[model samples]
Target: MSDAPAPTAETGTVAPPPRPHAVVAVLAFSGVVVSLMQTLVIPIVPELPRLLDAPASDAAWAVTATLLAAAVATPVMGRLGDMYGKRRMLLVSVVLLVAGSVTAALSDTLGPMLVGRVLQGLASGVIPLGISIMRDELPAERLGSATALMGASLGVGGALGLPAAALIADHLDWHALFWISAALGVVAGALVVALVPESRVRTGGRFDLVGGAGMTVGLVCLLLGISKGADWGWSSGTTLGLFAVAAAVLLVWGQWELRIPEPLVDLRSTARRQVLVTNLASIAVGFAMFAMSLVLPQMLQMPAGTGYGLGQSMLTAGLVMAPSGLVMMAVAPLSATVSRTKGPRTTLMIGALIVAAGYGLNIALMSEVWHFVLVSCVIGAGIGFTYGSMPALIMGAVPPSETAAANSFNTLMRSIGTSTASAVAGVVLAQMTTPFGSVVLPSENGFRTVLVLGAGAALLAFAVAAFIPRQRDAGSDRDPEGTVRAASGEGVAEPAAPVTRQG
Candidate 1:
């Protein structure tokens, strides 16, 4: 064996210098910065109509645009990363974020704001790409915890950004929020270029433009229909038409993907037991995690006149949620350790059960601020475990060449679940309202119903995770040959071949 680290078969480039710790820190920081975009606009959402001089319906596009852009960009970016280079594509993503932030900071109209938000959304692939880079560059011993932290950054940034953004929106010019985001994006991009190495992993094939376009159209229609259903009236012709278009486009897209030589998503590999079940479980876990996000803030900020409302300010509600982000970061190591000892499947199942328990606690004990804090932290811990294990499960099943794409798809599944949760929760709260003077507030029972549904989603995730086939020990050598045999449902018979590393 050579003294240098081995080169991955897909990317012929040798691993960079042994700076695993620095790389992990930089990448995790970058992920957190990218995820911050998801929540940065929430503080300003209610004011968008007045601020932009647009109707409430059009102002809503500020949020919806980001969602649509992110949904389209994530998998496309992943495929590009796999084809060209992960770090290179990561840099492109961060640059887009910086540009978007600056544009939004300068904007006073809906059109420019939408443009900026869409650019910001393109960076959403950073987490999945960062995880792939970790797998490529880090030693086996360090890979697990590093990727776990990377994954956890998604939640941590969202949780932390809420309060940070609320504070800025309250105290300073609204434009200051985007300026701060721009500054953070600049710092993150600089660090990535300075510390992170470009992975040699490349599939080096023709870009799948047809598949990409089809998937983009299908996803936009589907997510748009689901997200705007409440606003457009679920039974309205517009909503129904969008759903029909989405289904038809996706069905055709699936058929095209099956026949393509180099498809955007590798359906065959994804069909394997491990990958399929993990993706399904991921959807449920995502739904469960987002339900608390939707319900807790409203409960926290509702007026005390209502019997069960906590009657806190937006800032306070954000502060209460902040600790959950810290808990998620704190649990990363523990989640990795569980995966190392018990397997990712066990880690996922444990996480699902913990989430269910957390929702159960929220349903029973949500009358106090401390109750919300406790419940949020518990759910955050569970999410950390589930998020950490998902990439491990995905990477273990797919070829090294397909790592970024596979991880991106898994992330997309989680997004779908969250979107679904938001829609369902919105409908429930809208229909189940209590009268307070002339105004209607979400009834206490409405919140409880949503919590119950959250618990159900977690339990469903646990059931789905239970079906994942047991994987080999993480410490074992993971050669390309072993991956092929495993995908074919055969026992591992050979050790991985060692390719020489230059650095």
Candidate 2:
């Protein structure tokens, strides 16, 4: 076809079209940078009290604040992206990230650091936004792999971040970490402005401030209760009370959404078999994925005196696991191929099985450093396959207009799964420890249990994916080429005129 931008069916306006490869590269780069926030401070997590000059418990908020902020921001940004513009919100998220990085770089206290971290967390929506942009712009044939690679960036950034952060922490001032983050965010933002174009799809409506408030309150309460339950005591009144409040708020919010003319999350769309099941599978996959993270690092770094421990340094541990990230990147194209041929549902089920098998292998081969590398790479491949298929399944089910919101909600499910995994694994390890002189160490059996649980979670994902109806059963009007015939020209109305071309 032509190199020039063509008039979109939704909005008959001609704008400059970015080259497809340039668009994918810029968006994927932006996604990796944004996901890097998840692990940006891992090297300093244990030393937060010393670096921030605060009480140990208080300094923990630096991490918790980011978690809480991201949980609230993901869906909100997705909805806003659908309403205003994905590119607009993407720019806003990047700006917040840069601002946050700068704030943390200059801070030497806990309060300021927590504020900075929260701002950084708010940028987590960029991945979902990137997926939405690709769907709107790319050809159907390229859509599967492009979005899969975008989705896999979450794991890729996280896996790569550990070694990078460890090396920087060892060689440079801690402040340099945030400075690097700031610089990276600036570069990603600049690239996006240069190459990404604003998609013409959008819905016009008042921002659902009430629904937004409700979701924020509900998610914060629910996630806080889950993440901090081990710390605060699972049965503590505080935990129970937060769960109670979350239940009440979410129920009210759901009812309100159904009654409203325009909703924050289209409950109706989300309830579709494909979307709902894929989201559930995402949670299980997330839980399974996180167990490897929790177990591997500690197993690698534990004192050699412990017969089961490999006894490596933090940098060594990171380097060993780094291959997993590369493996994830490599699997992105494979994942797309599987989805294209066998369908995303089949791809998800197969991925979950592979993850389960990887965990099983991990249990059998825990003594050697190479074993760790091998197991991580295997599980990483499984995770890549599953992650790659998720956006395809989601996009196939929901309208193009709600693409960002649906993907954001799916991402949120994964976050919840990881948080739950952290809490559950923490409790297991704490209760089942070996006494090594004055210090207590996590028992070898305890690690085994975590791995087994990871396998179980993966199996659960397989079961969930099995429930996702095939596209024909789903009864959506889609072509064999994977274009949604039902969705064409059935999205949000376009704005009267271009406000500004920058987005």
Candidate 3:
């Protein structure tokens, strides 16, 4: 359909081509399994202090450790995947997830539990690595829907994990949760070993330890301040110190990156008008998406007597929200279709506008059970479109050598957006509370305010998407490395055709 595989220097023979469907299926499964880690412990978060015999504040570290670990691991793993092999790093990540789950499963104390969570967090690079794999191995036509399905796994796993975890926490011993995760990790890893192929599209160089260290320290500091600011008191010396250190360290890191020949992230490529603006929009879309996740569950679980609350159980709320994830999956092909015809820039703008409209509708629709379902489905469809298109926009601009690193950086920007959304939503909900007997809870107006903010963020994303430069010439998009594996026929399919010329 495209070109024959290029000969290798050593053997002068082409290896059997990878089965693109098997590769995509395995990688997507691995991504969804790894992403399940994000929401696995959420159902039990309220009882963590009691379960672990620790102060509520200390127990929050269970979640915070994973966030910090993921922030540090994601970009580093991507760089390593590019330097070494994506499939190899993917296996390593799955191993870490297995180990982390076993550790958490065995733990009776906070210390062991925290160790397990950090290991789980370290596995966060799986999704980006998986996307890079799809770009390497899949044919042009299959690539769009494949990448979209892989990206959507991030939300799919979280959405589905909630109800499953709630059901487990409700009936069985909580340790079963980690045990099942470990089992899923095992299945995912074994499937990967059997089905996925290691790509030869490597950046092959000495690891940039200094740059990696700088990035790790800077991101840890920044995320720590943002995540803990509320508990530590926003203006406290500790919080301020962390923020100041983050700002200074990141500034130095940016300057250092530009000077290094093989920096952790190529800021020049990142600064491309398309890459930069798409990343900006990614932040807003991520914020808007996570806002819905936070608001919907709480609103659904709140007491019915509160006038607007649905008075559903955690399991019920999760079930109510589950269809959104299914909707996201259902729309993957549709997203690829639109992206194929209109260009990813246009698709992203359409997605942002849809998300904005969904939020606007949510403001008026908050009173009914079916309303939550309908509103979530609308927003989920938008997310499906945006997530599918962002990677296309990114890969089109970056060379093959930088694919994993570039995609990982983009993923990190989304993480920052979600984290910031959590903080901002927490502040608003805290500030606008109503008394419910002995308990003080967020008022209906607080949720409406957050919805308004989400709509505004989505609008901001649409504005940013509007400014991304139009698609580049097909050949111009490739050959950034002066050569590509796709160009050489190095045992893998060419980029499912240049992203621009696909449809």
Candidate 4:
């Protein structure tokens, strides 16, 4: 085995070196908490209708609000981090996570809860920022495995958070969920402060306020239109207006990005085949992953009177999902092995295909509770591989100095996928409902429809994955932000590879 590589400081900085192994582990663990905070509220969804005196449709906003906020914030934060530093951005995000969780825990109404969720969503930016930091700070030898593990955490924490949320909500109160998340955030913040070194890589550019506002407004309107169209009626003025605003703002933003010398988003480079293809696949993977989150909980928690429901309580339902996360944990190393052998492109394609296969089977096999668990296991496995492959693809496509920005852009794409999935699934559930006196309940058909959509998303992801270039080991590629020395003790040389992908 190759000995661990050293972390070289970026030019003009003289920070002390961190213990690479310890820093990597701490940062990776922090990721698990960040991931958990994203979905820890799902198990408590059932209680929201009663506690907030709201309908299920209204209660769903708890999830949708966070998704919207995170989707808007991620890319902007990432780009800003590139202009500033990844470590600095991460610390800011953690503070937001902690504050958001605490606010959510203290909330007494649905409105306040939504406010808290939006705050929590800010931390979602940390995921990509952390991945980018690995390129800047971690040893080259550990980069592959470290990044793969962080990717796995995205699924792992979500999977595990289900059970934790259920247990806390059942035994205590929903407030406890936020409290735990807050604690996790604080711990992550502290660890990051101690273990992670600040980025010496600096791009002296001003923040693009106009570009950020445009992207934010566009994403919010677009996601809101999708998520609420079912409830608001697709033809209603509200829905149509939101959609129009989303399209117009996004189009204008694209044009503005081209004109701006220092854009909030670097559209030119992002539109390159390698980056573009990877981001498209990332969106599909996000869609498929969110489908599981949306459909499974309903299947688990619906009343036993419903023929499709397993009739499990929130706690039990969460427990079932919890075990699935372990499957994803097992998948990371396996994906690493596949990535090394066939390359990241093949590994990602295979992962997406597996997800499609699992969703297709879910359509046929979802009659029983155990079937849900089995299907979740397959989905978890698929997500593990797909998530593991994405960062590697992004890292390979961009210069080391731009790692945080590039990864953040990819993360933004995934968030867009999740937001779209949630919106579409909400629409399906709303339309396919069983009338029960004054109340309407979602029927089995709704979930099945969502699963079919998920299968299509997986297929699309597979197609995108096909376009990513296979990794070559012909020459050593060093971080553009750091100095490089030849193995033979020769003077520092030119970087062996260009950051942009070759057609």
Q: Largest TM-score belongs to which candidate?
A: 1
Model 1, C-alpha of 209: deviation from truth (Å): 0.7
Error of 2 at 108 (Å): 0.3
lDDT of 3 by residue, 1-503 (tens): 35344344345545434577788888888988998888899999999999999999999999999999998999999989988899999999999999999999998789999999999999999999999887776655666788888888888888888998999999999999999999999999999999988877777777888899999989999999988888788999999999999999999999998888778888887997878998999999989999999999999999998998999999998888888888888888878777776677887898888899999999999998999999999999888889888888888777666778889999999999999999899999999999999999999999999999999999999998999877732222243222233522243234443321110
By summed lDDT, the worst window of 10 consecutive residues in model 2 runs over 494-503
* TM-score list, all predictions: 0.94, 0.93, 0.93, 0.89
Which regions in candidate 1 have their CA more than 4 angstroms from the true location?
1-16, 479-481, 484-503
Q: Tens digits of per-residue lDDT for model 1 on 135-223?
A: 77776667778888999999999999999999999999999999999999999999999999887667778888999999999999999
Candidate 4 runs further than 4 Å off? 4-18, 49-60, 434-440, 473-503
Question: Could you tell me which residue pairs clash in candidate 3?
Answer: 139-496, 140-496
Residues 9-45, model 4: lDDT tens digits? 2342223234767776777787788888777877677
Report every candidate's CA lDDT.
0.88, 0.86, 0.85, 0.78
Model 2 residue 383 CA deviation in Å? 0.3
Worst 10 residues of 4 by lDDT: 483-492
| CA error at residue 388 for candidate 2, angstroms | 0.2
TM-score (C-alpha) between model 3 and the true structure: 0.93
